[model samples]
Target: MTVTESAQKPEAPANEEQPVVYKSNLEDFEREADVRLPFLLSYREVKLLGIAGVGFFLDAYDLFIINPVATMLQYRLYGGNELPANLEGFVKAGANIGSVIGQFAFGYSADYFGRKAVYGKELMLIIFATIGSICDPTGAISPSGSLIWLGVWRIILGIGIGGDYPMSASVATDRANLRRRGTLLSYIFANQGWGSFVGSLATIIVLLCYKHTMEVDGHTSKVDGVWRILVGLSLIPAFGTLYQRLTLPESTRYAEAQKAAQRVQDEESIEQLKKKANADPGVSEKTKHSSDEEGSGTQTPTVETATAESQSVKAAKELAHAKKGHFKEFFAYFSEWRHLKVLLGTCVCWFLLDIAFYGVNLNQNVVLQQMGFDGSEGTPWNRLFKIGIGNLIITALGFVPGYYATILTIEKLGRKWIQIQGFLMAALFLGILAGKFYTLNTPSFIVCFAFLQFFFNFGANTTTYCYPAEVFPTRFRASAHGMSAACGKAGAIISALAFNSLTKSIGTPAVLWIFVGCCIFGAAFTLLLPEVRDRDPDVVYEQELRERERARH
Candidate 1:
């Protein structure tokens, strides 16, 4: 019924400078953190998911909502004219640009400081950015100025979106029991599908509520309410999650890593004190003999002084290391070929996956047109309604189902297998879609697009997310994941900026072929990763380091 998480120091303290809890038996704490909590579906596990999961839900919502919002904006600002191509690219890619910054900054911060220290700060950034985005003063600004305004706010919004990648991944992996680590990570990420689906659903529902208005006034200014309301809806969840995120407990594994570090420093201080204490053997022996003869024994002043000096030396070293600790640790860990290659693999694969994934996604309206579901030949309300309805069907048919497929099969099939197959299958579909681009009828194109989405969710898209968080040791986990995620976002920025222009120049079929190539390369890069199921990276890293030291000796 209840799984008592053998408590490590409670993560939320009343104040920032509260005393550190020192546990001397670091191994026992390690076992407690890495081994026990995963034994069952406890309330603590649920609470952790709720707190971490909400931000990811927001991640997808904030990022993808822009698509529909952009469509609605055409009506609101341009009176149903096509959105300016340059502005459209900027508006869509802005969040991703900010995300790259957030991913790198927050990823390093999470690992370098502590998850506890920085957990909610990114969410705080997100809330502010979201507000800034929805509150764009369209009336005060020209259409072009308004687009620039939304673009700027979304860049800020992207930072929060980007930060969540590493923050949530590291938090989930550090605490997950090896048995269900993949499952836990998948479930947290699966919130994205819901975010995507719900964004469209809300657009539809809210637009319907204004059915009479849009119908009465074609290309009406009232469309402004639809986009703004959709953007604003995400705020409710953000506000609801703020108190919990700010106060949620730090990952137990992270806490254990900290304690282990303290223990090593303490041990070194003791060792240094002993070396200094015996420096003058004659004086120390004489003092010891005199104390024994007096029926009592005590440390000589020299010994006490040596101990104080050693403690002070440790303190000073700690302070200096604190200045550049995480920076040093990050570079040192990834410096070796063995470690560096793995990081590269995750980065390369994620980078490739995003290029294709976001390319298709950012231009979904184009795809919908290819499938005859674009609602282009309709009244004003009818056009918006058709777009909304098409999004709902497409998202429902592909996005959520694909994610669920991975969740169900990930443990048995393994992350590497799923990822490789997912990439290959997606490439295959993209190839078919490219070949049949003009030839295919509506039903055929829908089938290809749906299956492409399916494999993407089931393969590299979800697994790209899981791999980095699980494969790196605690010391570099956040930074590495952030780096990988940043690379992926960089790819997204590429596609977001280029997809429209690329399709215009080369045609959508050629663009589909390019995505096919990206997917094929994605599968190739996926080959670089080892199977991470049922293993802990920290233990593997320590073991490898020890073996290397022995070999060097």
Candidate 2:
């Protein structure tokens, strides 16, 4: 039934204990949940965050590691010639395409089946796909075939990585206390930086160990081991977190919603029974005496029996509703414009931020060259080592620190203000880089790139993830988060697919100009979103409920 139709049912008789009891219980749960949960992070909260963070860490590692690994594959598969331009973009963007599908599917599933039921299954998919990526055939297939094989596995891996966005965001936001909700989510998301760093660092370490052997061979055969090892190492963390995700209890808020839905069903059932009795006076008199005798024997038993009957009716209704499908309910719930606008703000802001963010990130090799890490001065093995070191250094200077800054001040700065400022500041740096593309010295370029990285994380990137998790009601929170994240990945896919070709056609200066525009538009879109600092979603939902009731009257 539509929410309005359900809400319009006749009020239960004043003497009915079932409706009163359920209302009181639900109110008490909300009061305690809002006031007590947000103030502290206990062991349980830490465990939840850690379990969720692992998926994000793996997501970043699997996605970003492709850059360096693809570089290695070019050497091994194509005799150090540059990978074909079409294949290069396809390989880089494959995971993002898979992630878009995964986000939508898993986001809706999490809401439909309950978070705990679907939480860790994505990790299992990642583990399997990561292993498959490592096993990509070399001699068995032509060069293009090999690249195609790896790309297909990356897409599968991307599906798992994509699922993590909504699953982890919903889990973290649901468990976090109102005061530290932003801080907790930042901690989970900060893992993306660490994942990127570790992916680079791992490649560097493996390359150093194999540098001599690969140099002596004079062919790219041994370099094949490097890509396999780098891809396979991700399996370690995914395996470690699997059991915990599978075992996590459903969020308290979700549990409460299940109870509330049940209460509504019970209220409706009792109303139906009262009408039935009124229509048959003879049966009503007989039933009335029976109830009185039962009540006289024990008032408590009579009340308990009525409450039990209400609960059973609720269960039956819930089952019937379940059979009708969640997608219908999802659209019905979000059909209102006010609710739809919040989803739009989250999706658009993320879309704009990612187009610039991933465009820079996935194509870091271009920026690294500007910083003098282009590997021109050394052998092929040494070039790989320098690239790895360059990635690690840039991540240390810009990426990791930016995420921590957001964690430290997200609550104080508020999501909307920080996102706005981050986008505007990032745009400023992009303009500087574009305007000085040819003239800027290596040190100056590095400084500008560092500032851009800092603001992207400290601003829209973190806030975009946190906002969807906080703004939507629990029933649709996961789906909304997934949709927003999918929009962001769509931006990432566009960057991955188009960055190389765009640079070839327009020159690097023009491309940077486009990114600067994306940042400016991202800032403009930030105006549409609400500030969620210290705000509880449950309280927001209650206020919305009251507003709807007033409109109906």
Candidate 3:
């Protein structure tokens, strides 16, 4: 028997009379197949998940590389002086603005077209944009000119990053087995943590190696090379997976559904021809006469006539369904209370999560410095190792393990409950940081930062990404995630633009307190969402859509 055939074999019920409701169609299979949670992926599922996961790591690496590189740029380009504040804010917000545009455009495209078309194009955009930004004319170009040029390139880069939100999530969702989808999907997003960890480690190693030439002007001129190297490293993963992506098969279930739709259309057309034949006097009379010639034959339409009429009816029903499926599908997701509520709860939680999450990450350097992660006032080598190696340690000890744990236990703890706990914990930690900022010394500060990072990964960071992709229906999943991620990115942009200034003006305590509030709100909002750990994404979504459609009548 085939794998699917094996999967289809059902267990006998304790009570023999209880009937099994085996799935009759691809939609049923699509939903039921996605929930596989135990362990081990099919070879095809693993390949797709790996490609999608790698995309996430690149996204994380690119986003985090700027953290250390920004300091280097200030020293090299601005002559290690206090540069204008507006320029600093502009630099931080450039990519974020681009991300918003990318999410909406590509998210809708994935739904309208297909996931495969949009999947790898983002990586190409990123590779080219990064190259452009690295080679931007530096010497003769005015600051404004460079700003405009860099900003434009960053926006392009943002588009690629934004596109990944829908493309990666949708691809993973499409390929995943239903039972363990949350676990499998979680593994893909876990790369972001690893990416951050690797970026930090790499930045430090590069700085240590190149420390000999480092100068502390407003910008570190020598560090530009390191930034270029950092930007270029992401290309490796992008290119490595490009081949697999080229050969990757579209989701079998999706293909089957499309084929079924096509077959229904073909059958309908043949039926229409039969109906026309049966309606003609000549054909009808001939069919009747032939039927009568068969001894004792009852007066009935000929087999061809009957087949054609049946086909035509089936075809008409299918066409009508196709037409009604379009507008009704979209309207059902929003017009209904249950679905609208789920969507709202998810979007709002994401909005709140991002406010805290991005605010902290955007200002991690400040926290690092506050915790005395700034290398000794002496050698660039020593400072680089301390910050870089510290980040590597966190990735190894904290992020990697935390993510793997989530993946292993998502079935047990459940996505909703886990997320609730994570948000609450994040809130609690932020509260601690806020309460302790002034009173805590270096070690205590480091401890707090570590704790916050732990929960951020273990809780909100990982689950926020996973849940949005899962909760929304397949048809709207990409758009919902795109909107949520875009909203989150917007929060990040706001944090990036305002974080430093806010920390400077109001102090770290106050800034952290704000994050605490957002986290608390996120935690509270998690209660509003359903515990969907057991549900298959596509099935749950389609069923919900169908129910909503029925209610409208």
Q: C-alpha displacement of 71 in model 3, angstroms?
A: 1.2
**Cα lDDT of model 3 by residue, 1-553, tens digit:** 1112111213445874343322323455455455654555655456656778886797778777766665555555676454467765666677778888988888877765556666678778877888887876756787556656777888898898888888888777765555767877888888888788779877876776676666343223666677778777777887888766555545543333333334434555556656876889787677667657754433545545656777657645654454334344557557888777777777778778878887877666666677666554544445545766655655565567667777887878888888888888888878988897778897777766677777777777787788777787665678778887887787788777777878899987898899888888888888878887866555554354345435643
State, as a TM-score between 0 and 1, how close model 2 is to the true structure. Answer: 0.86
What is the TM-score of candidate 1? Answer: 0.85
Error of 3 at 449 (Å): 1.7
Evaluate candidate 2 by giving its C-alpha RMSD to the native, one decimal. 6.6
| Residue ranges of candidate 2 with Cα displaced over 4 Å | 1-41, 217-219, 262-326
Ranking by TM-score: 2, 1, 3
Q: Residue 173: error of model 2 in Å?
A: 1.4
Candidate 1's displacement at residue 350, Å, is 0.2
lDDT of 2 by residue, 1-553 (tens): 1000001122455764222111222333345555653434555556766788998898888777888888888788888888988787777888999999999989988888888789999999899888888888887899999889888988898899899999988877766656677888988999999998999899889998897788777655788998889989998888888888888776666655554444444555566767888999986897799878987867567667767777668655674565345566578667978778888989999999999999999888899899999665677798888998899888888899999889888877898999999999999999999999899999999888999899989988888899999888776789999999999999998887888888999999899899999999989988888888877665566456546546644
Candidate 1 vs candidate 2: the TM-score winner is 2
lDDT of every predicted structure (CA atoms)? 0.81, 0.81, 0.69
- The local lDDT score (0 to 100) that residue 455 gets in candidate 1 is 95
Per-model TM-score on C-alpha atoms: 0.85, 0.86, 0.80
Best by TM-score: 2
Query: Candidate 3 — what's its lDDT?
Result: 0.69
